[model samples]
Target: MQALTSSFVSRSLVPTTPRRHRVRPLSVAPMTVCIDQSRKEKVVVIMGSTGTGKSRLSVDLATRFSAEIINSDKMQFYKGLEITTNQITIPEKCGVPHHLLGELPVDGPELTASEFRSLASGSISDMTSRGKLPIIAGGSNSYIHALLVEHFDPETNPFSKPLIPIELRYDLKYMS
Candidate 1:
């Protein structure tokens, strides 16, 4: 498996420039369109069924892109299901940093959708701040959807907070 993984990854390590795309927002009323092209950071998400090499692919991409991996497997969060969950081995990571892998105790409560989103978002923010690409890999569709699409209401989600826009972060005179 290691040999196969290494061979596949080595073949795909060529660096390439990022691509730009024009995005049009659908609106019912006429309004000025704003496109934020200044943001350069990109996130890679890999999702698939179990035993489909998702973890392997994520590690490979992380190596090629100088990225950190975030585990999104709902079962992989528990501490005692390493074998059962087929968690990625430390050696398999190939020196790439990984987050949220086997973090919670086995007896602890399962991670809620909002909690997963919050934790994953935090990891993404930290990685982006350090100029590292974030690679999210998992088999959990719900967790992925929650992180990417669901808006958190402050009344229900303690982690809900306004995020500083990239433009504003750069524009603030006191930031640097």
Candidate 2:
């Protein structure tokens, strides 16, 4: 349970499974052509209030878009705080490649915002370069917001538009 999106469906709700050993690399085909670094890659950042199914939506979308999941939950990154953290179980992930989940030890020093930015940005760039969609998700709305939208002024974004209509925001209604 985490941030829930209006479009979230329950069945594909993915959680992580604990791994006793190392995680193997996914069997994905290499890209034959190079992607231009100048172009921004598509990013899916799932954000909402806590216990709203954000993680579930992320896994569902990741599977739908063949995207990789990256954890932005600050608490879930630690090694020994599993119970307190409410991390996704590995089996629940359904074999999708998840990054930065339980990445550090419980006693490890807290990760600074700058450090997280570096790690998340690096992972996104790497994933995009390989032609996979990068899904950034977690219950930490502030952290996720900082990583995705803080640096840019939305008003100045030329491409920013009302992808989701204002009417849809209410009851998520649509016409046939």
Backbone clashes in each candidate structure, one number apiece? 0, 9
- Candidate 1 — worst ten consecutive residues by lDDT sum? 25-34
**TM-score versus the correct structure, for each prediction:** 0.65, 0.64
> What does the lDDT read for residue 124 in candidate 1?
79
List model 1 lDDT by residue over 1-176, tens digit each: 34533564455432244436422211111111111455544566677776656777778767766689889899998888999998988899899998999889999888988899889878877888888877778878767656665354324432355554322111111100
Query: Which residue pairs show backbone clashes in model 1?
Result: none
Identify the candidate with maximal lDDT: 1
lDDT of 2 by residue, 1-176 (tens): 13323234334333355556542211111111112434545666665555555566677767766689888888888887767877778877878888888888777788765567668878877887788887777766545544644342323432455533222101111111
**Candidate 1 off by > 4 Å:** 1-40, 150-176
Q: What is the C-alpha lDDT of each candidate?
A: 0.66, 0.60
Top candidate when judged by TM-score against the true structure: 1
Q: Could you tell me how far off, in angstroms, the CA of residue 1 lies in candidate 1 after the best superposition?
A: 27
Error of 1 at 21 (Å): 37
